[model samples]
Target chain A: MQFGLSDSQLLLKDNARKFFASECPMASVRRLMETGTAYDAALWSKMAEQGYLGIIFPEEYDGAGLGKVDLIVLMEEAGRALLPGPFFSTVALAGAVLSEAATPEQKKRYLAPLCRGEARATVAFLETGASWNPADVRVASANGRLSGEKLFVTDAAAADFLLVVAREGVYVVQTKAAGVSIELMNGLDLTRPQYAVRLSGTPAEQLGNSEGLARGLQVGAAALAAELVGGMQRTLEMTVEYAKTRKQFGKPIGIFQAVQHQCADMYLETESARSAAYYAAWALEENSPDAEAAVSIAKLYASDAGRTVGNRGIQVHGGMGFTWENDVHLYYRRAKASETMLGDATFHRERLARLVIDAHGALAKSA
Target chain B: MDLNLSADERSFRNEFRTWLEANVPRDWPEWREKPLEESFDYLRAWQRKLYEGGWAAVSWPREYGGRSATLMQQAIFWEEMARLEAPPMANALGLGLIGPTIIAYGTEAQKKRFVPKILSAEEIWCQGFSEPNAGSDLASLQTEARLDGGHYVVNGQKVWTSYGWIGDWCELVVRTDPNVPKHKGLTVLLLNMKSPGVEVRPLRQMTGESEFNELFFRDVRVPVDNVLGQVNDGWNVAISTLMHERGSYGARLHLLFKRNINRLIELSRTFKHNGCPAAQNPLVRQKLAQCYAEIEIMRLNQLRAFSRITATGIPGPEGSIQKLFWSELNQRVQQVAQELLGPYGQLAKGDLLAVDNGIWSYGYLRTRGNTIEAGTSEVQRNIIGHFVLGLPRSY
Candidate 1:
């Protein structure tokens, strides 16, 4: 069967590329990073106007009805642009959960504003310990009163709402609500700011049914995988370009087998990441039986590939790559942050191990 | 974007599955027993049966006695065969590589004479592109062929020729003009392996398999009509052959990797590590999980490359990307397998107390050739650097 982007998906990707190239180039990214703004409001509004915020949401909810693949296309562009903001936190993490978990009234009240970009939101899934397992949730919410701290929450300071993972289920709390305090963390990746939220008995509205949170995590992992693909791709391109121009000894560094092979390795990693992310997106869209396994595989590869390719990208750039003035480190920081954001490679690998063991057990019982 | 097979492709798979289920030897696993010659004969007969059943060359055109299947169909065919644990066709080199090249470049008469026998396993073929001196830089080959009235007198030595010991024909590349550039002066000829003054010396590998041989020719004569394409253009034909070899069989290789990982998983469940089952060990589990991820990457890479081919109607240098990934991935898989086996890793295949019949040891040793053969990983990186990334040539 055919297993590539359709003509329309290709068109969407190209348009997204052109949009990011013109609107959110690394120059603007660095500018935003310096000013300590979570994101550019003008660019976010422009993205909303382009209907990107609702690429995968239903039109009845003031959104587009495209599939997970279209979201992947957009997320990839966002990562390439290093668009500093709550796009992933707002649209991918929180939006996916709301779309799946929010009741008709809840969706009308919350998701409508999210799709229209009228309100920004982020999800706080990790406690002090950033465990990927839902069973490891330490936040407690009883009778709409939440008491727990969420660390490494992306765009927490900039969000109007926080979808906190509690022992009971998921709860939505206003960022400025009583007993809710948000502190911006001085993290490595300034492009996407991380914040630690301290909640002490904060009044929260319960999002009915925690069933969708697992799917939400899988969807987020898939989208993040797409973003990592973008970062890896740009890093590889930058490294290859630098190798072609940077001379060593006598000829261009690209002419040297050592540098050439390094770039080739980056090339391999980037391509593999792209394939893994795309397939995971497809699997999520189709609700394939292997979606859980596929999501973990994608995240695992993207994590490893992003870090390896980014580090190698820096290595290929020689002294320039080590300096902040060089853009290679920007990708490197983002890659590192994304690798540890939801869960690192080690976390996902263990999840995969469990899935494999469980499947083996099931097969044995049947036999 | 659907990964599942289309209806037609699924039907094609089902047809082959039915034929294979009924025809496959009941004692196929036992076929790998002592008396290697008898095993080879069994495999040859099985391939002939596949030919008669119309399942020998699924990717070949119908005019050449094949199903003329689409890329998806071809992939499904290979995947199914690998799942059934069927032996590779007796004339794999002939059917997979040289036959496609011949179809592309062979004269009308050449195709008529050569295509049918190749599918039927009547003619075994071996490639003679690499020489002792021209391993990676094949254009530097010193093999020479001079044209006479109706024949070309060839004198050359080729190494690492698979199936050379029993090959019926050799897809030999030679220098036809000494005055021109190395690449421009070459010619490709389908040489009769049984010709006078030809010698094949089987080379024992580290794995103890003599599947490859060294071929020496002293004035070996080949009919001028056996030349697939124009003289002095063998370099292009050789490149095409290499491309086909890499592009067409990726799905099959992916299944082979899958089968190996599955076996390794079963082995992990049984093998002991520190007085407990190795499967329960965190490190071993992580390693196995990594193997699964990498293998999946290999399969996805195949699908992406195959998609590009389907869209463009040509297998471009993008195919080189998968070639570079898979060869290295295969080595990594076998290396991990051997590491998991630990002390048993050193045991040869068919050893009395060996795990999985010591397949991991043999696989570990044999997989070294995956990177060096077809094209070295270094050469593959060069291709990606030059063609895919548009980097300047290192040379």
Candidate 2:
């Protein structure tokens, strides 16, 4: 079986890299972080114009009728640029949930605006502790009314609507609806802000089923894995360049075996994470039986690799890496934040173990 | 990016599976016994049977009496073989290493003399590269091969020679020009194991098995025609042999790990911890799950490397990445299995009360070599550093 990306896919990736580099440089990320803006409206519009926001949406809904794999390619570039926005929240999470679980009328009303960049939305799944367990959902929905709080809801303050995960099912609640309170919280990753939203008897529409919730998570997690890979790839490139130019003693520090090994280890981590991420993206796109397992595997590896490689990126830069003036800390913060989001490495590992046990049944010997 | 096998490949796998079911003996040897000669003979006979069935050397080209399977089919063959928990071919070194090298660099006469015999298991092969002093830095090996009259008088020693005692031929690497640099002075000779001055002493490992041996050559005489490649180019030939040795074998090793983990999962269900099934223990379950993920990653990484090989004729330094990951992952898996076994883990293979006949215990000990052989973890990291990462050489 062929595993390499198609020629068109490769061309899209190259174009995305150039676009991100030229359009949304790290300076824009720093600017958004410093100004306390939820995101750059101009850049969001530019991205919508680039057809990235609708990369995975069907063309019938004013979108680019591409696959999830293509969306991942763009997401990777966004991550490399550290593009500050709710692109992941809107496209990968809420967008996926709507298309997968919503009725035709609901799609026309909800997903169409999201596809056309007329509205921003996000999925508010977890209530409190950073647990991704389905059983951890505590938001209650009954009789077309919603009352609960969603903690660490990403980009909620900037979104037009929120897909709230509730005990009964998912409810599409408007952010500005009465009896709703949205509080912005300072997060470890300044590039992507988090919010705490409280809803009290807010009127909402039922998505009818959580049919695609798992699919949504898989798509989201795979997208995030690609982002982590992009971040790590840049970290490695920066670390390598720094090592070659930065001299210590009589030669470049890269010549030192210890530093060289650290760089080598980072390279290994980044490449492995990329491989896992790519496979997960492809599997999720194809809806393969192994997609869920592949997502966990990719997320598990990328979560750990992101943190380790990012920390090593800073470590190799020595004192400069510790400073806010240096850009390495930006990726390090993003890495730490992303490592626990959706699910941590340990959490994914436990999920994977359960899957193995379930699949083996009597062969597993453990209930 | 389709990961599923194509129709042709699937059919090839089915045919191979049916053949195996029809031909493979139901009762196989559980473990090797003392004096090993009978078991070794049985193994050779099995290899011959496979060769006669045209299933041996599936990865080799058709001109060499092989099926010329594509990389994917070769991978499928190994995967199915490991799935059946099939015994390794008796002439693994010949089939995996020497045969490929000979095809790449041997003379017409050399190919005619050795190729078919290797496939038929009439002549088993072993490698003679690593010396006591030249382990990681193989080019520093001081084995001497002086041209005397019409023969080369070889006097050197090779350690960690798998199947040395039983092999009919040794792919020997020696220095023919002592005055030149370490890498340039070497030569490769197909040494007859029955030579007058040859000696083989088995080395006992931590697993209590003498699966490997040390070879001592005291002026073993070899005809000049025995050289496989050009004189003083043995270094390149040795590298070629190593590339073949490391390539695509990961698929087979991955299957073996998958099978062992399946067994461990079964054991976890049967075993108890804190008065409940051990599989119910969150910690043990997490450990097992971690093993499963790592093993899957090992397999996926091999597929990625396979893709690279398909794109480029050669496997690039990415082999070092998979090499480092899988070797370490294999050990971690066995460690998890041993931990799951609890008190039963300490039992030896033949102990009366041992679980799975103490296979886990033996496996735990045997995996110690997983990191050390082929290439040490340190050496792999070095390769990644210098070759893959373009870092300055530590040496």
Candidate 3:
């Protein structure tokens, strides 16, 4: 009945923290975000060397066989470092779906290259409607050719392949294939660049069923929640540090009850989000009965908490927090973007309502 | 990372479940329907039955008449109690706060004298720490005790004393030295409620319940041997009791929130809203789902706290976090209840058309004190700020 990380998981977390602190610090993140791709190939390969690219894939696919919990541990560290690139889109989103849906042949062909960092992939889930629901997918594929647009496709510009969600099923499309074009979007979170991918009769291969895609979305939501937890945590630390040093009214602003309580509220939100995120990751790993509900809960709570902690973080920093020169705004931007990426709090809350109402409705009927 | 119970824990849970299924009073809910004062005998008897069944104080050491259960087993015990809707133990303060303090700081003689009675509900205990002047600033309390012969002559008053009216013993903190610092001059004494010049006046809360009282002590004498710890270190002793209150109440509170939420869900199905069942309303569903998520988070947060305690033999500042979250969350839940039930929610108990015997209304009022009692939300935030976040203490 323990709710703590295992010895190996703790080691993984510590090593990930140290790795990000050294390899992908805020300076490096800033440097990369200014670039068009907002990505560093060398950093990608280094993470691959560290086995993070395959942290959740099975060993049969030449990957490190770890669970969703382990993936979250890495994702959280990446989030703290604000590690700019396609790590989330490549590994957490696309990799999760591929691992869940791919056959041995498909996995060996696509997943192995991803594990080795030879290729990067991103999931093209949201359509013009900007809904995460698979049922909202309007892009149709006929005879393994897709012709439609996928919106808010994260890291699509940096990806070698795209997992396009179409009306038929999830399709794997080569990003450089004929009739496929990627245009970078004006994303608020510059750290993780997004792109609009337009596929016109693009040759593709069907990867998996909608059920598998749905399950993978849950994993993605949980993973994003973990990332949000990390962002919230770092924001809290930054806010607390700023409060301790930023003097106002002849004393550190932290000495004032107003500022102190705000910081405390940040701590509360961050910690609560962490609990939700970690539990979601564990539930998915264990195939717990509440895994679906837990994932939505995590995403819902983290989506709200991330924005809140960011707001408080900026508020504590006063003028400095509002400027691009300071790193606090970067976290704030990422929080806002991430809040809507998987499913915003409102979206997840409605999803949760469906789950709860349906379950209770069934129970009432059976009784 | 593993949340599944081990074989031993499962067996222990099963054993307790069996006992509870067989022994739990069938008419316990009926007893609860009576006034709080009238229900004491039933509650006390229930605790005694648990003691006789070897289920009382499962987390305490075996030498102290407990089963010496592991933390997981203790958690399972609470979970099962909630599952079965078992009556609450009459000596909750004795078992949860005073008894643990006695075990931590009591002499061997004190343990032998108090521990058994606490488990058996032979004696009920109340905390006498907060005074009128020392609600949040407890160190500023003026409850004074002067050493007289073989006893301490205590004076001054303690307000908001839970279970005071029926308490057999009082864990009283008094200022033993006025010359020293306010925090340094205090002492904790085990005072008999029957002592001369002691008074307990019922304090009616907004819920119309006299669950708490104002305790006045005009030279009430407490024996020297009744002092729980050192004479001038009552501050530390009281802190320990408060920590216990904050840290260990999570599991029980989780069950309570769970029960209330389930009831709310059931009512939402029957209650009308905008020409439909409230459960069918999109807004109400969102509110209920949010409450459900928070309640699940509460349970998970409790596990995290338990994990920390298991890893490190002391409760960390996470207790303050849980306290702050749950108190505010309860208020939110009650507010949602009002929104869902409308005017009927405001009906008092025994009202002809009151929903669920007006429990939602009672809860709506009772939960108002959750944030204010134990510690105010402001005080909790201060604790989290100073202790958890390393923020400078507010002046």
Candidate 4:
């Protein structure tokens, strides 16, 4: 098994880090976190222009045709910026859903625009409490008009379209279409926006059926895991740097064994997150029989690790971490928000348990 | 770079796998009766098999019967062994730490006598480094070994000696002179455990198993030939042992807990209550998910170590990072397994139907000593943050 990053993965990561350090200002991150807006439109366009939004999609579809690792690099830098809105939800989720489950016709229509960032869409999968069970979808579908409410829909209010998961199937519905409604919800962290979606007879085009939706959700969940892995790594890296520069008790806090140990643990945490994220990213390379299990495992790791490193980042930064202005707090907020966005850590854990059982049974039969 | 093992390496790994399978004694249930003795026997047997197969002494010179295998191959061998569920090695003290130190600084006679014996497992060994007062500040060890004529009259105590009771020999650190800094005036001694006045008292731990013992040496005699390096200059020798401990050039430690996590998920499914499998519970699902996450992370940390070895042929102080994470993950996984058992977790085997066959409690007890072994997690983290990450050193 390949145990480390490929050269392209490393290059992609370095390039994203260079770009973010240059283009995405800390002040801009602070502003976005305060405003609860999606990323700056101009910068969003810049990412699109750089061919980053379509990183995990096909080159024919206007994507960079990169692996999960490549997009992961972008996600990490984006986390460093604490850029608000739906870069992850739309590009990572909506785009992934289209790439994975959409029919060829659907992909030709929606995938191209999404890859190019000409259109940004959000996923309405989590009905409540940030869980990712197909059964969790309260929003129902009937007569090509999807109705019911989707809760905690990340970036729902701002997106031009909604990729809704419902009992009837997975459908694409315009946010401004008939009977479509969105209400912004209060979130602990403002960097990522959330919404409550009420789809009352909203005109919709079905993209994938339940199975298709399940596959698509798997893709989205995995991509989100990859993103969180990146986020946790950069967040920890930034916090460690902050620990070195910040002084306490007449010495840099990093000198204290307590601080050093905490930073070391963060390093371990980030590394752990990276492994799962990278493996999930690699799943996009080939949708083999093992892909689903790999993705489930990865998502489980990233969501939990993202939250931990996020909280730890703030802790390592001390008082400034609690402040509204510091970048550390921004990452902490992203970690918290990312957890609930694409099925919290607990949801994937249960899915993993089921998969393990099923896998064991299969092995038993074969034996 | 991509992490593909080369064709040659792949073949090497396949050969190792085949060899282990063929050679692993059929009776693993009785392999290591005494933690120390069993480790020694199994390791010696394994080492002999490797030696006969021309695979032993991975990092030694060609003349010394070593393969000089690539660091990645060594890592692959360890991983493969873990995958195969082999018994633990016995001569780690000599092979991983002290033997490496001897090779680095020992005279030709010293190397000839010790290295081959260590590989053949002729003499089981334990570390006499950490003392009652000196652990993290290891240089402060007070086990005095005074040079008398051509021999050293050693007297004092070395604690936490893993398998000392079963060990035939001990790799010791003793104060040769008290006039210098704590780090200075210390000498490394390869002393026979059965030597006069040597005592090994088992100290039972929270796990109910005594993995290590408190070793006391009251005026034991060590020959001049037993000195690993120069008199009163062992701090440097000890440093190399620590380095070898981090690098792949050393002996292998069987980290078998990852398998436990996999097996646990399976057992949880079979454990049904109220006409439903325990796996159906959302809480069970979540804990499994979290365990999956822990396993992935643990694997990643190991991957980092593997990556460094792939390029540099050496594991730096950064090796401490992997060691720390693995230990912590082992502890956490065991902890979670019990926590997931709910109230039934409290019952052990043969206690009115233990939860999930009492697997969680068994695991929890076995891993209790993990945090203290190799090196404490606290000590490891400090090393990583400072030595590797370039943070300032704190006490």
Candidate 5:
């Protein structure tokens, strides 16, 4: 058994890193975050040209026809660059949902344009309750019409369509459709803007069943976990660099054990998160029996590690880390936002607990 | 990226599993209940059985009485062993650390003489690196050995030597020259434990057992031929031993921690908290689930390390990452056990109501040494800081 990237996967990862480095540097990230929707059309088209927007979509849909591992590899690179846009919402969230649930006709009409960068889409899953559990969904769709408020809907303002998760099933609704209201919320993560979407009798079409939506959420969680790993890695590099150069009394502050041990912890957490996230992606790609538990494990571990690495990163940088001018805060903000996005640590841990309990119960019964 | 076992590996696993199912001592659970000293013979016989089946030291080279198995096979070996709840071999230090060091640095005669016996558990081994004065700063050890008439006259003490009393030989590191740097003046010798003037005094650990000892060497003479490597170059040899310790310990620990966690989960199902099973408590479930994730991460991290070694032909600094993680993760796992079991967890092994025969209690105390032994977590961090991150050494 090999636990590393294959030659092609490595090449894809390297090319993606180089592509993001040139196309979506932190400077561009900052420039775009200041915009109204934090969505750059040119960057979105460039990503589509790279086939990232359709990395996991099938060839029939004019896509790259890659797998989940490939998607995470590209997502990790985008995360490292702090790529600001509707990419994650469009590709990782909405694209995954459509790929998992959409009919062939739906794929041709909706997923194909998303693959070609002609449209943007995102999932509107959370409502007033703000819970990730599909069972907690309160949005109602009746008579092919949606009438509910979806809070913290990622990139809804920038999306051409919204995959609104309703009590009946997932529904597709146009963002600019009559009776649709989208207001961009002040989000902690500047790079990925969230919005409140209000639907009053908006015409919607049911996309797929609850089973497909659940599968899509798992894919999204694993992808976000990979993204968090990238953010943690970059934060670690920045912190370690600052520690080596930033002198305190007589030597570099890194020479101090207090600083060095914390840096070690950061390195440990970042590497561990990478392991968990990559394994989750591989598990999902393989459709392994452990895929559900692996996804929760990845999301749970990365959610905590992302915040911790950010905390330690800022701590090691001392006062400079606190400045709005420093890029460290940007990663810190992203980590904080991502921590709670696709089910926070507490949420996933509880989910894992149930899975473990059921498996053990099954074992006991068999025995 | 492929974690699926190849056909060869799968066949190897099946072969080993069959052998183990047939040969594993059916009385291991009772044998494990015996004191450490009383179980040596049983463990030795187990190791011999493994040796006879050619299952001992699967990762060692073919010439050294091993299958010359791939790293994945070695991992599979450990996994199957844990799965069957097989008894541990008598010569853990030997198989894990000393034999590998000998394979790397020992002379042709040395490998021929020592390697097979280690696998057969004929000559159990213990490392003699840490002195009373040299715990973290191990290179500063002052255990001196002077060359005299083709023999090294050793006169120093080694502390915290595991299996010191039972070991047939010692992989001893000693200072050969006082005029040079502490690190440069060292030499490693394969000293027979039965040598004249050598004394082993049992040191009781916090667990109320003398599983280790303080070894006193009063002018113990070692033949010059017994030196494992070149004179005054024992630092690198000893470092190789420590590297071997960190390199593969995670796979072993994974099975062990897995057992403990499984036991904890079972206990959580029975133990009551707030008028319900502890497993029903949200806080307990969260803790258990977190520990579960951490343990899984530990396994994945080990695989990552193994993948790197398989590619590079040498263990990388990532071993330090595994070392740092599992040591602390085990501690957290134990703490969660105590939290779930409550007051019953504090009972000793002989106590009537002790949980899991007080294994958790013993583990809680014994694992305090995990981070301290092999290398302290602080020492590991220092290594990661200097080696992995290229930071300036704190010292």
Candidate 6:
């Protein structure tokens, strides 16, 4: 019922916000942009040591055993700070997927080490031109082998392991495993290092059957939505700051009626994104029957809002905002990339249309 | 740093949420039967209840018997409580505005006496800043304060003070010198609202509430002890309180939207134009979608403000951004509610079968005050553009 966060959740969130504000600032991130690697390995490890890497998993599996809502809180702060790493994928997708689909033995093997931040993993699910269709699994996981390509994988270049979804089922593919090839791409947001990974008959451990893949993908999508919720928070903050400090026409541009109105609009987008994200995360935690639909709605709005708020950030910053040195670009790129990560707003809208159309039998609600 | 909450803070948040769920009902009271005075009483009683429960001053200092909760915690309290559509509380003309100002600049006696009363809503308060001619140019106010033997005599008129008529006291700005810049030679005073020679004329607003007031002062006299800060230092004090006030009230954008949840549900259930539920209409759906999106961003901005406050101890001028962002959102969201009903929306409150029983019409009229009330939207953008973003300010 707490639409936002609990008091204790706020404490954790503030701690994370303070840590990132001081430790992984935009200045530090800008300094590391061309470093080719997104994350500060030592810092990432420290984050892991803090149990952020396994925020939502089971305590028995060495997790904090906090709910996904709590992780959503951290993820938002992480987004606010633009903490450069494989955090979104590792904490959000891999950990959540394993929790949803993995056997107890699998959780003991992956979730515990992952929670402790000793190992980093990501989901390799979508192929080129395929974004939101979790059922679009052409890559096959059969006969103890995995083969398929996952494009636009965030931080795949620096990952220790990859959890790949395939036609037969879900497969665990290590970055260094045999028959696996990775091409590090020039990402829009250097903070979130992305990759083009091609796996051909890679030695893989199959986690579950096709049904399991379905379940894992849903978890991953929901996690992505939650991660996006975080990113949108950062976008709004950065833009607001930019609006305050950036000046044009002999005074601060935010003082202008037009600019302030635009900022307000952006704020609205980010606010809606927050609600959607929180509701989605909360639903998952509550085990609501409507969790899937809520997750879809959350992801859809967040992706759209990520782009809107991210762009508005630049608008608020104006010229200096468009420059490469500003942290605004960090959020901007992330928003653009993330908007289409699991799916675009339109894609989610289509998905939502399908849901309502199916569940209630098509009432022509679209107009 | 982890984003987990401390067990106690978590408990505080849950308890607050529970309290709001149980005690603070957000339904707009019966307008005619429950007038603005009644509304004020409702709020005052609720504040005392919360103050007794020790939830009233979520962000005030501990010395004042406030919980002085972290910024994020305060924000979390507001956000969660707002989501429940909780009924109004005795808001912080004192706690958020005067209390923080006094903390920063008040004499020990002033702090000891006024702060507690403000927290407990023991005395209702209002601001006497804007004169008929000195709104955006508040520094240009001609409300004169002449220093007499051990007392200051004030003569002036102030307008548009919300929650003003029934207030027990007034935190006001008065001019002490005319031979200086507009912003200089000013003083802030704490005068009894019921003081002799003080008149309060309530202004009924579109929302069927007389939340705004016009105050007239004729030789209002108060001891030197009533001074808030240094003589002729009212501008700085006012600025500080205004910032805190902005931050506190900036959550209004989404808070108002959340209050409309029932209205939205009703509009969805009944506002028919072509045949389908207005909610089913794609345009209305789009409006809802857009409204939903804007609400999310407002929430995120709110979270950012809370996080910043929690992390930094005192929120900086960035509070202006939240203020600016929210004021405009309130304006737009209310517009959506009105437009959702088409021509039927044109019906005023008394019209039959009016949209949401004409609640939205009241809302639309009331929402007009959003951008205007807490500094005009134009001024807010200027603040954000000039102060926060370093953008050019419109003259």
Writing each residue's lDDT as its tens digit, candidate 2 over B240-263 gives 998876675677788878878877
Candidates sorted by lDDT, descending order?
5, 3, 1, 2, 6, 4
Ranking by DockQ: 5, 3, 1, 2, 4, 6
Q: Please list the residue runs of candidate 2 whose C-alpha ends up more than 4 Å from where it truly belongs after superposition.
A: A358-367, B29-38
Q: In model 3, what lDDT does residue B72 have? A: 73
Residue lDDT tens for model 3, A1-367: 7898888999999999999999888889999999978889999899999999988888888789998888888889888888898999988899888988777789899999999999999999888888887778899988889999998989998999999888888899999999999998998999988899999999999984445877888899999999988898898899899999989889999999999899999988887888899999998989887888899899999999999899889988999998989998898888899999888988887888776665453223211
Against the reference, the lDDT scores of all candidates come to: 0.86, 0.85, 0.89, 0.73, 0.90, 0.73
* Per-residue lDDT of candidate 5, residues B1-395 (tens digit): 98999899999999999999999888899878688899999999999999999998998889888888987889999999999999999999999899989998999999989998999999999989899999999999998999899999999999999999999999999999889988999999999999998999999888899888999999999999999899999999999999888888888889998877777887788789988988889999899889989999999988988898899897778777888999999999999988988898899898999987888898889889889988899999999998999899888
* Number of clashing pairs per prediction, in order: 0, 2, 0, 8, 1, 53
Which pairs of residues collide in candidate 2?
A365-B269, A366-B269
Query: What's model 2's interface RMSD, roughly to a tenth of an angstrom?
Result: 2.2
- In model 6, the number of clashes is 53
Candidate 1: tens digits of C-alpha lDDT, residues A1-367: 8879888888999999999899888788888887664577898889899898888889988888899988988899888877788899989999999988878789888888988988899899887667867788988977779997898999887789999988888899998899999988899999889988999989999887678988987889999999999988888888888888988787789988888889888889988888888898898898887788888899999999999998889888999999989998998898999998778888888888777653454222211
Off by over 4 Å in 5: A359-367
At residue A284, give the lDDT of candidate 3: 92
The TM-score values for the models, in the order shown, are: 0.98, 0.96, 0.98, 0.88, 0.99, 0.68
Candidate 6 segments exceeding 4 Å error: A1-99, A104-206, A209-302, A309-334, A346-367, B1-33, B37-124, B148-151, B192-210, B217-225, B250-256, B269-273, B278-312, B381-395
State which candidate, 3 or 5, has the greater DockQ. Answer: 5
CAPRI grade, predicted model 1:
medium
Q: DockQ, in order, for the candidates? A: 0.69, 0.62, 0.73, 0.47, 0.74, 0.15
- Interface RMSD for candidate 1 relative to the native interface: 1.9
Alpha-carbon RMSD to native, per candidate: 1.6, 2.0, 1.4, 3.7, 1.3, 7.5
The docking category that best describes candidate 5 is medium
Return the clash pairs for model 4, or none.
A38-A85, A272-B297, A349-B285, A349-B289, A350-B285, B32-B38, B39-B90, B40-B90
Model 2 / residue B364 / CA error / Å: 1.4
| Winning candidate number (DockQ) | 5
Report lDDT (Cα) of residue B206, candidate 2: 86
